[model samples]
Target: MNHQSDQYYIDKVLDGQVNMFSVLVERYQSLVYTVVYRMLKNKEQAEEVAQDTFVKAYKALDRYRGDAKFSTWLYTIAYRKSLDALKVNKRFVSSSDIKEIGEENIELVEDALSCLQAKERKQIILDSIMKLPEDEAAIITLYYFEEKSVKEIVEIVNLTADNVKIKLYRSRKKLYSILHISRNEW
Candidate 1:
């Protein structure tokens, strides 16, 4: 939707036009779910957290001041909600069972990157991202996948710009390392 259209919807949402918020929801559900799934790495939990993120966003709609883009605000909620889910899940699962995303995706890429196939590279990148720390993963996903800026990331992640830069640098390094280790440079 256009900026003017979204703003109009936001006005509706803020003025007790609760159901109108679904337009916002339909617009951003995938973005929110991707953030949650990237962080939690568990489909079920990601879905739950994504649902909660929208619910929380709706309840706080009146308080939104538009200091940041509405998308940024939604992501901030999803990121925090996903982190909370991870903390709770961390207590119950063994690390290995959690499946390091880097390694899993690497295996997927092995098949796709070859002359005979094409799905491997994406999986490799995704796996490497999954292996990153939560903050790094969020930065990579937001910056690379969602095409958000450092400023937007800073607001959503509640980090300073410098920290976001550092995280992005480190994340790129980790991703390169995975590629290097896999001997699949492309």
Candidate 2:
């Protein structure tokens, strides 16, 4: 949505045009869900958290002082909510299709394994990202996936520019290793 159009929608929503808020919801639903899904890795949990993120965003809309872009604010909520869910669950929830036999004995079945091919390499990279430390993952997601610049990322992640750069470097290396991609490829 254009800046003027988004601000209009937000103003309307704030002025008791509650139903109109769905437009904003529809616009951002997939982006929010993808962020939650990447972090939680469970379809059901991700859906639930995504829903909560929207609801929370709606209830807190008045508190949103327009200091950041709507996309950034929405993603910050989703990221935080996903982290809360992970903490509550006490373990990372892999996709239901994934099965584990032991610490090092887990294996993806043929169908699931196929999803890790070159075509699905991005998903594999995302899976590895989900395993990263929360701050690092947030930086990677905001900067790379969301296309937020370093200054914007600093605001969202509340890190200094230097720290964010170091984290990004370490995160890229870690993601490359976890995805089994050659460093040169990265």
Winning model by TM-score: 1
Per-model C-alpha lDDT, please? 0.79, 0.74
What is the C-alpha lDDT profile of model 2 across 48-81, one tens digit per residue?
9999999999999999888888878888788889
lDDT by residue for model 1 (73-119), tens: 99999999887887877733333532433343233434444542346
For model 1, what is the alpha-carbon lDDT of residue 131? 66
User: Lowest-lDDT window of 10 residues in candidate 2?
Assistant: 97-106
Question: Looking at model 1, which ten-residue stretch has the lowest summed lDDT?
Answer: 97-106
Given candidate 1, what's the lDDT at residue 74? 91
RMSD of each: 3.9, 6.4
- Kindly report which residue stretches of model 2 are placed more than 4 angstroms away from their true locations once superposed: 1-4, 92-119, 181-186
